[model samples]
Target: MITVPQLDQYKDLIGEDQLSQIYDKVRALSGLHVMHFNTTERGGGVAEILQSLLPLLEDLGIKHTWKVVPLDDTSNHFTAHLVDMLQGNIPGQLEAEDQQAFLDTLAQTPILSRPQDSQADLYFVHDFQLAPLTTLFPWLRPAIWFCHIDTANPNQYAKEYILRFLNNYNVCAFNSQASVFKELPREHVQVITLGIDPFKNKNKYITREQGMQAIARCGVDPTRPLITQVSRFGRWKNPWQVVDIYRLVKQHIPNVQVALVGAMEAADDIEANDVLADLRKYAKGDPDIHLLHDPTMIRDQEVNAFQRYSSVILQRSSREGFGLTATEAMWKEQPVIGTSSTGLRSQIIHEQTGYIVDDTQTSADYTLKLLQDRDLWRKLGQQAHEHVRKNFLFPMIVLGYLDALTKAMAFAHAQPNLSGGQKR
Candidate 1:
């Protein structure tokens, strides 16, 4: 394990008082080994959060090993199609071949289904896609699955499928309590809010001229009102719908610019490409609207600059796994307009920090409102920045996971019957 004086870097952002609290919390788990498993190391928010979190775990004296399950083209496609259904698309039932492919992926990925060799003290699995791994390696450790996807409105097929292995985990954690509480058993479910690193590349200090230069490099008109939605090209990101909302807003502000910015992340990641093609077809040759997939433009510094330069940030996800990008923009002092779906509803404080809008019409209205009233936008942006500083930084998320793990350890004692049980 690699250790560094990492906590001190965050003291400037979160303050020494809170940093000391986090150090104390982590110290409780000082010598424990932690293993984390997820579907991919990129493209998804779980991977992104873990990338930021693992080093901090090591710095805090936790022996941590992060693993990514290899999903071949077949199971990979199944994963993408499932997210489509979660985004409200129609999905065909999973065939026996699909199940076999999933099993093959788990069986083949040695690092993922580990201790078939050596076990860790705490096993952390992320989301439904990897839930089946627990059934394969049942005797791992005191396991808790961190669900980053929305469970409140899970796809019927996925909900039924995931329930098969829910018992395999000692405890389950969700992004928010409001939506997912009813979906899960009350005894074992935990609410650990997602957070971002304000000291990240995008969150670092930059000037207005630097931000404008970065936006202009992406072919955006810096003078025009710019509306940005920065996330994966996932269908749930509501990427195309954002274009529709942009066109509607354009009817009101003729010279306003719209930028749908994201990057393709997996070998079998075709959904982003499919959506981008549709967006290109819809945009056709309209110069005011930019459908960008340039790898150079998606870098953290570039994304940071775009958020800094945006007139308004759009987080119109239909079902969000907590709007980390929206929170990042809020940290950049940019006003966010998010939908009232799962995670986003909890992030935006509705006109205090930013606005909570439902449909594309409402999103457009708010975009126009921000474009029209500079003072309100500025005020909301300021409040949004402060809100993130108080609640959504890196240390807060690490502390949340540690707190939940401590509670999960207690829950296992109360429900000893469920620990590694094959049947719920």
Candidate 2:
């Protein structure tokens, strides 16, 4: 079992007054039980958020349970395609066979038995993978469909299919307003940005020397300025463009090295291997261009080291959900150069928090500036860290969830026919 530090432990970082306010909100949510459902228990942003959030919820005296729907080879392939369609990569209806496979897979999962055993007040169905759970289990009242993806321009068919399940939820939460579909009721929508645990292995405090040593173990020269982008190998993350940006940066700074870090084991992301293979081919044996995705080599400690020691971090995603990588870097007082994706826009304040660029040229330009100008880098890094501390930390996110749950419960109570908690 994974243990999360107690809420009180964050008192110093979040301030005593703010922590007290969080407890007040917890009082309002007294007796509430939240059930979270997703495709996998590890990898990806959703799992990371839940891993921290759920344990904290337990510590707060809230009843909660997490369940992962089992995915076989067939279902995994179908759902991966489904994710692409939802993200607007595939702009058509899911094939009939694929839809059937998705449904069949869900039907076999033991999650169906969970509704009977667990008396959850709210069902928090994450992303499109398990959105249909609201419909599959009619008793799941006051459910919140928390979507952590770039759904600003999802495929029409995918949008319609997802809406069918979303309509059943009490609230539809998104990382940004841009991700919310127009079809969803205005009242049903809630924009709750994702957050990072400051004390987690990936974001915890480490000395500069320790950071340097950790990166050196991974073959990264500690002396050279490192430009890193840590995210999963998703097409939307724009891993290829990161390589382009690196090459552009290397043009001016000969000693500069770029590390493209990503997780390759996300079950829903079947395209990771393909994208990584293509990235390797594109790099063409550039000695400075480090493509670090081996889980054994680049775990949380190494990521923490890279972010802490790097001159600048890049989150040049084409369409990011919330860019937790940027948030992580920001929390570590590392300046990030991100694209104008909605999520990045929400986290970055342009020149104030961090720089936001449109293309590889601008991204490269910003990277060069941050590397060359030490004072500018420190200014942005300090501002970025403060911004994350105020807005993107885990305690703030818990407050957001508590507020959303309070509103959802009220919404459910207002509906004459609807009722929350277990039916049995």
Candidate with best lDDT: 2
- Candidate 1, residues 261-323: lDDT per residue as tens digits? 776675446677778887788887889888777675577777888888788899878888687
In candidate 2, what are the lDDT values of residues 229-338, reduced to their tens digit?
99988788898888888788888988888888875767777778888899889999989888888888888989999888888899888888888889999988887888
Best prediction by TM-score: 2
Per-prediction TM-score to the true structure, in the order listed: 0.91, 0.93
Clash list (residue pairs), candidate 1: none
| Residue pairs that clash (backbone atoms under 3 angstroms), model 2 | none
Instruction: For candidate 1, report its TM-score.
Output: 0.91
Cα shift from native, residue 21, model 2 (Å): 2.9
Query: Candidate 2 regions off by >4 Å?
Result: 1-5, 416-424
Assess each prediction's global lDDT (C-alpha) against the native: 0.77, 0.81
